[model samples]
Target: MRINQFISHNTSHSRREADELIKQGLVKINAKIAQFSDRVKQEDRVFIKDKRIHKKTQFSVIVYHKQKGELVSHKDDRGRKTIYENLPKKFSSWLSIGRLDFASEGLILLTDSALIASALMKSDLEREYYLKIKGHINKEVVEAMENGLEIKNEKKGAHSKSKISSMMIAPFLEYEIFGSSGGYTKLRVVINEGQNRELRRFFGHFDLKIMDLKRVAFGIVELDMLRAGKYRYLEKTEYEKLRDFLRINAIKF
Candidate 1:
């Protein structure tokens, strides 16, 4: 494999991230600093920073509290704001595991290893989101969403359904869902799917307006007391827990 490809597959660093590592003189091959275009043979020793490459410690994960209007990608063609700009200078060579639309704000996971990112992004990984919608959400609508609905494109001959797992519903605190144009309304929703704009699409189907959406939890990683726009290093235990989760859940074909 090529050096860049090797880094991408073994760690959460994207192709671009691997290139940056090469430029920064952090990646080594066969006891020598490796270039981005260098080819990696099976026996070539790879080192990231000062540590020898090891599958157990190869990836680092972080949960970022994204703000509205920030693009999830590292760079945007339209010069729009990006989450990368908000990260500290040392938070380098990481890529988002999944995306949060510019209009949404919530927990976003980023990683330095591509393999770990791929594992967590798989469909079986259960993610949790909390949404505040305008007005009362009819119980029937909730059931419809839980049961899965035919999305817009699937409205034709063969309808398709996007299912939510482990849904929990209750009334949200009146003040919790503030900042909407409409009057205070009681709404509480929890969903397991992290599909793009999924909560908004579900509300749109019922003609209900969504005021705010936040992803509160991802697997075992929860927002906890981490303030918005702040991030911390993922401890070794956290990474091991995630790896164990994947090990137990990975599907075999």
Candidate 2:
């Protein structure tokens, strides 16, 4: 494994943060300052700030049926409810694979392994959502979904403090119209990205207001019958699938 990945997998630091630590000369391999290109073997010793790191060989993951009105955070200055408040004490320190906005309800994956969380968060796996929008699906929407869309002004559905002004949307993997009438449209859509407010921004660009949005799946994991605000460990098959992914990607825990 690369030095940064080794640190990320064995410690609380992210890969990027580990890189920063390396740049600052705080990371060492066998008592020598490590380089970015350095790879670790099983016999190698890795240390951070002079403290040797023990390789972690095991990880845990869980799925949470996140409900609306809960923040995906550990704490908030304004005292809003966070997912940690609802999770068991043992899972409070786990990191989310991605995020569900405060108003969005969905299946969210959390993991005790930073490497696993980073891998899933950055992968081009499919995300499936069920959405209800306050407008009929139009030709423009269909074209954009099929061919992808690029916009220079992409702040419509972004956080007020967000500095992103442009976006490049990739084409949807698949979409199915469930119903369209009564001044609302319901549909299921799949995309292979977790871009910032992607679905919201896409619909918002067309002046279509999303009344409801719920994620039902990510990659090969399905929400199934999980109740809102509840959580469960990944099924055995799901873990097998994840192991395959990690192996294919050359990721080791």
Candidate 3:
């Protein structure tokens, strides 16, 4: 693996931070300054700030049933409740895989292994969401969405003009409509890529308002019976299944 990946896997730093440390001349390999392109071998002696780094023998992964209104970050400037607040104090070192906006809720994965987290993030794994929206949706809109739609960028300032920034093709890999009720419609959407506010932005193109959005699953790991505001360590079988789904072999330190 690359030096940055190795560093991130063995230390508390992120890949970017590892790169920064290397660039700043803080990392050494075999008594030589490490380079960004360097690859680590089992025999190479790697050190950071004169201290040797060792791979973790064990790691932990957890699934949290995040509740709406909770921030995914460790701390919020507005003093709102965050996912870390709901987790046990021992999980302070764990890193969240992805984020759910304050208005969104559901399954969020946390892990102590940056290797696993990084691999999972880089993989094109599918995520499923259940959403409730206002207004009626027809086959034409669905088809258009499935094919792709050009979402225009909103004005940045009061004096700015809106323009077509980019196109958002069928955000959903698969979708099923559960019909409508009380002027609202329920739908399940599966997407391979996790773009920022993608679902909301896609529906906004049609002037449809999203009333509720909750992630139900990530790849092979489903929310299942996990209650909101609660979390649990991933079962060994579940973790193995996730690793296999991501096509990642055993994580070596």
lDDT string for model 3 (25-126, tens) is 999998999999999998898999989998677677899999999998988788999988988998876788887888899999999888778777766788
lDDT of 2 by residue, 146-252 (tens): 99999786688777788988899999999998887899999999999999889988888898888898999999999999999999999899999999999999976
lDDT of 1 by residue, 61-176 (tens): 78899888888876888899888899976565676778877777778888776666666776445566666666665666756655666554321211134343322222221123
What is the lDDT of every predicted structure here? 0.67, 0.90, 0.81
lDDT for residue 101 in candidate 3, whole number 0-100: 84
Model 2: lDDT equals: 0.90
Candidate achieving higher TM-score, 2 or 3: 2
Candidate 2 — number of clashing residue pairs? Answer: 0
Worst 10 residues of 1 by lDDT: 166-175
Give the winner by lDDT.
Answer: 2
After aligning candidate 3 to the native by TM-score, how far in Å is the CA of 239 from where it should be? 1.8
Evaluate residue 81 in candidate 2 and report its C-alpha lDDT on the 0 to 100 scale: 96
lDDT of 1: 0.67
Best by TM-score: 2
List of clashing residue pairs for candidate 1: 11-113, 11-114, 12-112, 12-113, 12-114, 13-112
- Specify the poorest-scoring 10-residue window by lDDT in model 3: 155-164
